[model samples]
Target: MAFSTIKDSITFHPLGDAAIVIQAGADIREEIHERVKQLFTCIEQHPFDGFVEAVQAFTNVTVFYEPYTVHQAAHLQTHNLSPYEWVKGYIEGLLEEKWQGGGQVKRRIVDIPVCYGGALGPDLEEVARINGLTSEEVVRIHTKGTYLVYMIGFAPGFPFLGGLTEKIAAPRRETPRMSIPKGSVGIAGKQTGVYPISTPGGWQLIGQTPLPLFRPNENVPSLLRAGDEVRFVQMSEKEFFSMKEAER
Candidate 1:
């Protein structure tokens, strides 16, 4: 059954009792991702009454809210509208307004430092062989491209980036590793990402970063967000060690 449409480009459907999913478009294109991000930002800035958080994926944004507070809102109570229905209407209305305003969301560029090859990148040679290129060439191609932050998932502060160069594209390992160190940079298929914290993964290990992707004490835990631009800056082993020491 058809639920509803927004801007003739997206489909909105109920996710659960406390959340709704706005499916904007198919594919991981920047235009659609930006729209989803903008809609999420708009709702965050102008939350109804019980906004919680938003989770952005490849082409959808999941909005979570407190139904109790929403039902208690004076305007909603007076209108005798169900909380879910009111939220759905409000989001659809926002989309219409944004379309009329010619909405355009700006992307943020984030630079990350990486120490590639050698011990830092154990699978560097394998990645190069799989792509039919030298280790140096692989590094050049990987670093030169500007990647988009498609979504942040798997773990807190972990960013799933897209737009990797074809020359450096490599599939994930057949057998997943038991433990991957934190700040590990990896490539799987056409996407590249960093391991925010130490955990198991199938992505081919390429390098390691000194950046703290997740810090609970900080106001903002995640270093990267959806719709952000990511660039990999090559660093030396000495530089990586120095940076790590400095952070300590």
Candidate 2:
């Protein structure tokens, strides 16, 4: 089916029976991400009869709704439309209204302290070699850039961060690690992320953060969220150990 485009380069597509994806653009950019977040806020504030929740990503927002609630809505009864159609129209209306009141939400700045190289970052040197850089230069490049949390997926609190400069960009390991330590900072291609929990992964290990990215005990388990700004602060091995010990 041909996709429909709206103002601000937005597009809509139905997802199965109960969800619809609203895309801002074809590429990943900060402006496109801002549009996605704006749409997310619009849907959250002005929900239709069957609205469930809106999930944000790099260039789109996936809105989930309860089909039954939509189908039974008195206003929708006269339209003789399916749930998907009703929801699509509703979102279209929102888009036409310029994503009402979704103006520039304040972004949170999150600082992640890391100890780069040595035991914690086993693949640090490998990454440096791949990029024709020294381990110190790689660390300097990484800590200097500010990253954006484009989305939270793969694992709980695992933030897919953007804004990795080409200077330090490295490919994933040829072989996946059997088990990665929790809070390990790794780079896969143009992206960088921290392992929220111990799991198998292929990203080149570059550092380890002493802070816990995932905390199940908290009401909001994930330490980070989409739209947050991230900055990496370099710490010494001694400081890393001290912080880790304090967490325990």
Query: lDDT of each structure?
Result: 0.85, 0.88
Candidate 2, run of 10 with poorest lDDT? 1-10
lDDT of 2 by residue, 225-245 (tens): 999999999999999999999
Per-prediction TM-score: 0.91, 0.92
TM-score, cand. 2: 0.92
Q: How many pairs collide in each candidate, listed in order?
A: 0, 0
Candidate 2 residues lying further than 4 Å off, grouped into runs, are 1-8, 98-105
Per-residue error for 193 in candidate 1, Å, reads 0.4
Q: Which stretches of candidate 1 lie over 4 Å from their true place?
A: 1-6, 74-81, 98-104
* lDDT score of residue 141 within candidate 2: 96
- At residue 222, give the lDDT of candidate 1: 90
Residue 98's lDDT in candidate 2: 49
